[model samples]
Target: MTTIATPTTLYDPPPSFALVSPFLYRSSVPTSSHLPYLVPLHLKTLLSLGPELPSKALQQWCELQNVRLVHLGRKRDVVGEASTWKPVQEELVKEGLQVLLSRENAPCLVVDPSGVHEVGILIGCLRKLQRWTLSAIFAEYASLAGSQSRDIEEQFIELFDTDLVVIPPLENRIDGVRDVVNDPPLLAPPQ
Candidate 1:
C-alpha cells in the first residue's frame, strides 16, 4: 500500500491581526507562538504602542529577523489610576503615521497589548487623514474593537485634525500615499 504525505500549516497570526493597508498591519502583542506567523510578512519594521516596553525576547526576535523595532509608549505620570489613563497623544500618533507612510517602513506591523484602543485610535486617525467619513471610520473601529471600544477614543478620532498630519514627499512615501496627497476633499463654499 502507498501512503500520501500531508502538508502542515505554519501560519498562526496574533490575536486581532488585521491589515490596515497593503503594507501595514495591526495586532495585539505577539507571544512566542505567534512569532512564527510573522515570518511570512517579511516585515521591515514593528511599531509597538502602549505604556510598556517590549519583552527582551521580542526585541531579540526582531534583531534576528532583521526587523527594526520601534516603541512609541510612555509611562503614565500618575500610575495605578486606571481612570487617569490618557488617550494616545496626537503627536505620537502623527509620528507613527509618518513611519507607516515611509516606503522604507513598508510591510510594518503596529501592535499594542490589547490591540484595541491604541491601535484603533491610530487607525481611526489614519482613516481621517485618508479622508474617510466619520461614520465609516467609527463603523470600522467598532467592528475591530467590539465592546472594548471607548467613547473617548471615538471622540479623539472625531476631533483629530488631519491637516496637522505632515506627509513626506511623493517619492519617499508608499504608492497609495499619493491618493490622499493629490486629491483634496471637496468643500462647499461658506454660505
Candidate 2:
C-alpha cells in the first residue's frame, strides 16, 4: 500500500527563504549546497537550458530566487545577459528527454516535462521526424530519502549539488519534489 501524504500534512519548515512554497521557484533548486535535504527540479524548465539561447527569463528567475543551477558540462560561450552555468543537457538526454535541438543542430531552449508519458509521446513523435537515440528513464523523481529518510538523504550528499528540498503537487516548489520522492517511487505499485 502506498501512503500518500496530502498537502495539508507536510512539515512546514520555518520561513527562511528556505521553506520553499509551491508557488515560488519554478525550477526551484536551492542556493546552499547543504546535505540531508531534498531538491525538487522542474524537469521541463530544466530542459529549457538547451542548445543555448538568450536565457533571460531563466536567468532572471534564478537570480530572484537566489538559486544556483549546477552545471554538468564544460562552460560555453555566454553571450548577452545570461550567465552560462555549465551544461547538464547530457544528463537530461540520459534521463530520456530526447534533445532534438542537439540533433537539428540548432540553438534552442526547449524545456518542459509534463509527465513521463507525455515526455514519452514527445520522444516517439520526435523519432519520426529525425534520427533520435532512445534515452533512459527521463522524468523520474530525484529522491533523497529511504526507510530512514535521513540515511537516504545523507547518501545523496555527493549526488545532489544543492540542498535537497521538496515541493508538493505539480506546483514545483520544495514540497512536490520531496513529497513523492521521499521513499520509493510515489506512484509505484506494491510488492
TM-score leader:
1
Output the worst ten-in-a-row residue range by lDDT, candidate 1: 75-84
Writing each residue's lDDT as its tens digit, candidate 2 over 143-185 gives 2111212322222222332222222233322222233344356
Q: What lDDT score is found at residue 68 in candidate 1?
A: 96
What lDDT does model 2 reach? 0.28
Which candidate has the highest lDDT of all?
1
TM-score of 2: 0.21
Off by over 4 Å in 1: 1-6, 75-86, 178-191
Assess candidate 1 and give its TM-score to the true structure.
0.84
In model 1, the Cα lDDT at residue 166 comes to 78
